[model samples]
Target: MIDFCNVSKVFNTDLLKKDFHALKSVTFNIPEGKTIGFLGANGAGKTTSLKIAMDFIRPTSGEIKYNESLGKNKLEAFKNIGYLPERPFFYPHLTGLEFCHYMGALTDLSKAEIESQVNVWAIKFKIDFALNRHIKNYSKGMLQRIGFLATLLHNPKLIILDEPLAGLDPIGRKELKDIIVQLRDEGKTVFFSSHIISDVEEICDSVIFLKDGEVVFNGSVDQIMKDNIKPETRISYFDGDSLLTEVIPNNKKEEYLSKLLKDGKEIVSLQAEKPTLEEIFYNVKKN
Candidate 1:
């Protein structure tokens, strides 16, 4: 678990460049065993916040507090946290299996342990056959899968992934999502940043939206949709040879439906318009 309290970060080390504030008093809490999505567009401080949380960069102000158990030593703390950057760097010459073993060693795992875990994850990810091939020969999706395998090699309690689903085909995205869900089922906390709202909607229990270096929204997806999206119900009916449709406020659906039936209209279909996360995200951004 992690907490960001009024965190702010500014980049101005270069005298020739203007100061850029990547984060401005962004505050959020990541509870354990939950999938939390950091939703934001490009340059919205998602990566900046993650970097600050991992202590890769120092914040201009505020504090990031980790669980007491993971706060004592930096190296020890990282042992329970797995991180996959937006663009992962792999040893191009190394085979997938060798890379996994190398990453496992960095995490202080024994050879036998790494081999066992690699076998299990390779099969789960359906990349067992590609493990012997050099990483340079793998496709983008294959590389992404290998990155995920490396991240999970240590069995970290919290997994931090930046744009994990980006650049993958639909099937590849589905596979990665399934793996994330499995992590949740196994009680591992997942904190990932993504611009793709649909992916977050599918997996995240809670979401934090950022815009222009500010925290615009932080709450459950359902609550956000209910608060930001207008309620509407649509009805379609057939009148003789003509088709008619009516859209009404959700609160007045029952009253309007009765009126339609009383008017001898043959109702063909009735449906409530549920707002998608994409709609909700855009609505929030516009405001």
Candidate 2:
């Protein structure tokens, strides 16, 4: 489990005394065996939060707790965590296989284990054929795959991916999304941050929305879907329909619900509406 306590991060510049609060008193817990999508804009605190949890950066003011029944060390919290940053910085001289092997060595994996894992994930990421080529020669999508393979070589329990599908073509994005879902099915706890709403809507068990360095929403997709409006028929009163006595006065409380359920018989839609993820996102921001 990971917890962010009263977390806040600020970056300052002297020119205008600009202080961008990346996170604002944010607190959330991710349980085991769950896949979560973190959503926010370009300058939002999504990266900051992930970095703090991964111990890549210190929070300006707050506490971060990493609890592992497996007794993973603080600095070694990364041992059980797999992370792929926005832009992976790898040695231009190293081949994809060489880089992954180096990462495995860094994690203290034995030669046999390293070789087996590297080959497996490389094939899965479609980088096995690119193994001998220098990383500098690999395309953007191929680099992303190599980065992903490098992260997963250690077989971590928790995966943190940043914009994993950022620059991929449509097919590449779909394949990557499928791989994410497959990872979760294998019981690996997954957490990813993405600006793409459609991707999140499809795979996330739950999401926490950040806006201006604050958590604006924390709930399941269903709650987000039905957040604002009640599930009832909308009535536009007709001139001859007795001006709709179905107002059901509040003083008579029991009668209100009864009248609503009984008399809300006819309704029309501006269109056959489905409160999609985009709609829910709008509701969160609007509220």
User: TM-score for each prediction?
Assistant: 0.91, 0.82
lDDT of each: 0.91, 0.80
> 26, model 1: CA deviation in Å?
1.8
Clashes of each: 0, 0
Clashing pairs in 1: none
lDDT at 58, model 2: 87
| The 10-residue segment with the lowest total lDDT in model 2 | 265-274
Cα error, candidate 1, residue 227 (Å) = 1.8
lDDT of 1 by residue, 1-287 (tens): 78899999999989999999999998988888889999999999999999998999999999988886555667777999999888776989999999998999999999999999999999988899999999999988888889999999999998999999999999989999999999999999999999999999999898999998999888888787677556888889998989988889999999999998899999998877778899888877888
Error of 2 at 136 (Å): 0.1
Candidate 2, residues 157-237: lDDT per residue as tens digits? 888898888879998888889889999999988889988888998998888888878988777876777664434332333
Candidate 1 lDDT? 0.91
